[model samples]
Target: MRSLLVAVCLVLALHCGEAAVSCNTVAEDLYPCVSYVAQGGYVPATCCTGIRALNTQAQTAVDRQSVCRCIKSAIGGLSLTPNNINNALSLPAKCGVNLPYRISPSTNCDSIN
Candidate 1:
């Protein structure tokens, strides 16, 4: 019985690890862009790199919604000004990513699909 329990636990761990990336992962990926988005200036190449990676990673509807929620939450925590929000919204175009939905704190993630 102990061996069976151990096997079950191992399987569950593996399954959880294989699950889709979390909102925190998305937030981490976008963390580097905060400065650029917060200030009015040329966005660094590294910022674009992270944005593109986020676009590619969030391909599915669920993933997109997760990303949206993460972006909203992450930006809210940043204490950026209104201009920062505008600059952040322009990232997709600047980075050449065609995001399916707007990146805003008020966005409804459930309506992404």
Candidate 2:
């Protein structure tokens, strides 16, 4: 719950060029879809598709608290840091999205942007 909120808040804030996008939405939205994958269950393509939609809106993200919250809710027990931030941002991009990274938190994602 906290993770989801954090991720959303970050993405929402970044839309104005302050935040950076995290792939929490991709993980959150996809993790529950094929619970029985090991049992031979199949995940719908749309799950990733939806993640892509969300990513489109977050290209200029801010890396806010909400994104961290969303990541917490999505990853369960993982930690947050600048290292994995790129990976988290890359998830939805695999599905076909811009998903750019910003240079600084003080800046609106990109220094020039």
Q: Of the candidates shown, which would achieve the greatest lDDT relative to the real structure? A: 1
lDDT of 2 at 46: 68
lDDT of 2 by residue, 1-113 (tens): 35544554454333332245445443455443222221223435664565555555443334433343344444333343553444444444445545343212322322222
Q: How accurate is candidate 2 locally (lDDT)?
A: 0.41
For all candidates in order, the CA lDDT equals: 0.66, 0.41
For 12-56, candidate 1 gives per-residue lDDT tens digits of: 233321216565466556656756665658887877887888778
